[model samples]
Target: MQTLVLVAHPHLADSTTQQFFKASLPSTGVTYRALTAQETYDAAREQAALRQADRIIFQFPLYWYAAPASLAQWEAAVLTRTFVYGDHRYPLADKELGVVVTTGMPAQAFRRGGTENVTIDALMAPLAALAHRAHMTWLPTLAVHQFNYLDEAQKLQLVVDYQRYLTQPAPDTLANRQAWFADRLPAMVAQLAPADRATGELIVTTMTQQQDDLEALMATLAMIKEQDDD
Candidate 1:
């Protein structure tokens, strides 16, 4: 699926979180548009980009509990009746709408009892409503909190997770997630040295064995239940 990432950052070049997140995405099937302070807004180009994408992601740093003015302007210019609504048609129908937001404070602060005193979902309600109005599917938001506090290992894992969020077909499902990793494991193992490749294969084998064993146990339980019913 084609993904269009619209980044609304006043100073995108300096943001560590946005840079890392953008770097994590694969080069193919993804388009990045950064709304910088100097660029003039082109409504036609923006509308064309939205029309081409199967998934549209709005990436931004949270400013005073909302996105920056650039995104609002883009919305006003592009999300008009001529392009998004009216005429008994919706250009964005069946498309996916996702948000990736970065926050200076900790994630815990977004909850009811915390500093922000509101859930992230609550804060993103306007975007969700926009998606609904546009006939787009509203995806779960990826919120990066206290980004400066994360260690190297944590950041690495975050990249992997964020990449999956952007590219995976069924990111929220365990079976699809396992399949996605399994599909990548072989190519990843091929890139390793001889000894590392051997170790990687061994790990994959062990995981496969465990999965088989669990499936067998489930089958046995089902048979036992069938006999009890008889």
Candidate 2:
């Protein structure tokens, strides 16, 4: 189950931040492929990667409130109905998909009524929906907001965090998070220390924050699809 990192920056040669992030990633058993050099998105390469991967990550900087042009083009050209749908509607089912993005604007700028007037999550709705339809587990987006403002130490920390975030197992989805924990309580019980067990209740309670986020996105996508259907 190889993890495929699909990098989609048009001008990788000129990108400092993205290049640094790419170079920092550990290559042990991980497949890193770029979608830039081919005269067009190569379906054979895309399918081969998909066939061999257990996780697929879309890494890019946001462009026009979305992914780089190459990513959008790859999606349009590679994710065909026959391969991604038709018989294999869930081509990547039970697999993981995440977006790793670097933004020029400060993190605070994306808050509601802030400079961008929308959150990062809002801006990434299309990818979230794509994850759902493809049946790939969607993870919390990893964002490098204000990549230019971070100091050397901070940049190093961000690199480690980004690497960890990309490699970690997919976060529990809202539709299944509670049920998953409930079923795992027996296994989790033996690991809980006396003092830790007392605090464990807080862990379950706080997970609702993640659930609220997933539910909101799912509901929003549902409405969007409904409008499209009409």
Candidate 3:
């Protein structure tokens, strides 16, 4: 699946959070662009890119409960009525819309009694509404809270999590997670050094066994349930 990440930060060169995220992006099946890097946008061109993507992501830092001015500006110039819905083509329909927002505050702060006192979802209602208007599927937002506070392990985990968010199929389940890893394990093992390759191959073998065992157990349960229903 093709995924487009539109970054809306005014100073993309200086944001470590964004830089890290960019570094974590998979080499294939993903395209990224900084929306604010250019002075103006070509409405037709932007719409065409959006149409090509299976998943569209808006990545930015929140500014006063909304995306920065650049995002709004891009929306005004590119998201023309005729392109989105006026013609009734609904070009974005069946596509996925998602958000990746980085924040200075903690996750707990985005609650009724917390410091910000407003949930991230509430702040992002407009974008979700846009997805609804265009018949797009709105994905659950990926919120990064206080990036500077994360430790080494958390950062390592985020790499996998972010990659999955971009490429993994919807309704994230254990089976799907296994499938995603299994698909990449061969290439991943090939990239490792000779000394570490054995361990990588072992992990792949073990995971395959686990997957087969899990499937067998699930099929057994299904048969028992079917018999009970009879």
Candidate 4:
């Protein structure tokens, strides 16, 4: 399936971290298009690209507790009722959707009483609604924090790492994901390339569907455990 990475960083040229990440992409089989250049937001281009993608990953730095303005603009202008919400013609209905965010603050800042005030889940509510309305499978969010603190070498490593993480297959379940991380962490940590480390530190945040499924699984297991105990 072709994965489309739609980026929305306002100042891509001045950005050391995001720029490097964009430049280092390998074409192989994946189709990539960057919309950072100052152009009149084209709905046709955006919708066409989206239609071609089997999986769509929105890559951006969180701006003012939400996605970049351009993304919001695209969403408003392009994702119309007939195309995205109302009719069966909603192109995104059966595809996969993922979010990749880079932030300046620590993870704690986005918590209940943390510096940023609102939690990540609360801030991402709009996207969640969009997923449900579109019937797209919402993958876990990939969030990278403290991008400004990383040195040049660290920044490079972050880019490479982010690419790998984005391309990695979605694990079947939370338990399976945890197991995969445990098995892969040692090697992933040791062989971390220069341009891949930034994305390496990213926290994969919640996907509502996955969370609900995990809760149900946990409740079932608890009941089984109680039966065994009895």
Best by lDDT: 3
Mind giving the per-residue lDDT tens digits that candidate 1 earns over 85-191? 78868999989999999899898999989999998899899999999988999989999998899999999889888877777775476556766677677878898
Q: Please tell me which model should have the higher lDDT, number 2 or number 3.
A: 3
lDDT of every predicted structure (CA atoms): 0.85, 0.77, 0.93, 0.73
Q: Candidate 1 has what TM-score?
A: 0.86
Q: Across residues 163-192, which tens digit of lDDT does each residue of candidate 4 receive?
A: 554554564555654544544555565567
Q: Which ten residues in a row have the lowest lDDT in candidate 1?
A: 170-179
Q: What are the TM-scores, per candidate, against the unseen true structure?
A: 0.86, 0.71, 0.91, 0.68
lDDT tens per residue, model 3, 1-230: 99999999989889999999999998899999898746689898999999999999999999887999899999999998988998688999999999999999999999999999999999999999999999999999999999989999999999998999899887677788899989999999999999999999999999999998998898898899999995
Clashing pairs in 1: none
> In candidate 4, how many Å is residue 73 off?
1.6
Best of the two (2, 3) by TM-score:
3
What's the lDDT for candidate 4?
0.73
Worst 10 residues of 2 by lDDT: 177-186
Give the better candidate number (1 or 2) by lDDT: 1
Model 3 has an lDDT value of 0.93
Better of 2 and 4 by lDDT: 2
The clash count of every prediction, one per candidate, is 0, 0, 0, 12
Better of 1 and 4 by lDDT: 1
